[model samples]
Target: MGISRRATAHWEGDLKTGKGQLSTPQSGLLDNTRYAFSSRFGDEKGTNPEELIAAAHAGCFTMALSAKLTEAGFPPEALDTEAQVDLSMEGGPQLSQITLKVKAKVPGIEAEKFRAIADDAKQNCPVSKALSAVPVALEAELL
Candidate 1:
């Protein structure tokens, strides 16, 4: 069986000046959260699509890494992953690049093995696969 998640967005007005609200009904993490062009392209204190994508990517990759490391018999004591998504507007606004950096603390795991596992997690995570059209870079550090 496949699991599904959903979010809804409501917008009013034009692109440059329109205001929007996003909601994740199931989780309720976002209940009519506000977003706008100013938030996305300017210095407005609100959430935007790119920021949400970054959060999703970071969370998905971290969970995948945990599972992969556990399967390799080197469960991580700690795992910190940061996903950065760059939006470019050279021609048009598009996701240009995604970078995943992870720092892990696991006992008895060689650096080489950890790197391989981190790379695997990066390559196989659902979010990474979903964003495959964009260039993705991974930096893994074993601590």
Candidate 2:
């Protein structure tokens, strides 16, 4: 069976100055959280889709890296991943690329081996798979 998660959004008014709210019933992590055109396109302070996508990608990649390390018997002591989603508007608004920066501390694992696992996780994580159309670049460090 496939696991399913859900979030909902409500928007009012036109695209440029419209206001929106996003919510996830199960987690309530985004309970009526605000989003707006300025927030998405300008420097206004509010959540945007790309930011949310970056967060999800970071989380998914981190977990995937942990799984790979555990499977290889490395079992990382700690892993931190940050994903940056770049939006472009040359033709139209679209996600152009995603960059993942990962830092890991895994006892007794060689740097080369850890790099290979990190690359694999970046390529095969669920969020990476879902966003496969967009380019993904990874910078991994073993600490």
Candidate 3:
């Protein structure tokens, strides 16, 4: 079975001054949510595509790590993952780098084993796979 998800983005006007709205009708997390150039590039506080990608990557990787750990007989007590997306604007807008930092709490798991599993999750997570064109770095810590 193939599962599909959808999100819609609506924009009006030009790139620099245009206003956009994004909605995830299935989840209802965003309903005509606002996005503007200022939000994306300036100091305005609002959700942008990069920020959303970071959130998605972090959530996906953490869940993937938990599943992999469970499969390895070392289920994690807790996992915290942070994904950072760097967008380069020199030639044009491009995703330059993505870094994933994960701290995991698991009992009886050696550092080498945990690192290997975490790297596996980072490489195999859906979001990571989707963004394979971009460079991704993973730093995993076992606590």
Ranking by TM-score: 2, 1, 3
Q: How well is each residue in 1-143 modelled by candidate 1, as lDDT tens digits?
A: 99999999999999998999999999999999999999999989889999999999999999999999999999899999888999999999999999999999999999999999999999999999999999999999988
TM-score of each: 0.98, 0.98, 0.96
The candidate 2 region of ten consecutive residues with least summed lDDT is 25-34
Show model 3 residue runs off by greater than 4 Å.
none
Per-candidate local distance difference test = 0.95, 0.95, 0.93
Tens-place lDDT per residue, model 2, 18-137, is 899999998989999999999999989899999999999999999999999999999999998889999999899999999999988899999999999999999999999999999999
RMSD of each: 0.7, 0.6, 0.9
N/CA/C clash count, model 2:
0
Any residue pairs clashing in model 2, and if so which? Answer: none
- Per-residue alpha-carbon lDDT of candidate 3 for residues 40-98, written as tens digits (9 for 90 to 100): 99978667999999999999999999999999999889998889999999899999999
Candidate 2: C-alpha RMSD after superposition: 0.6
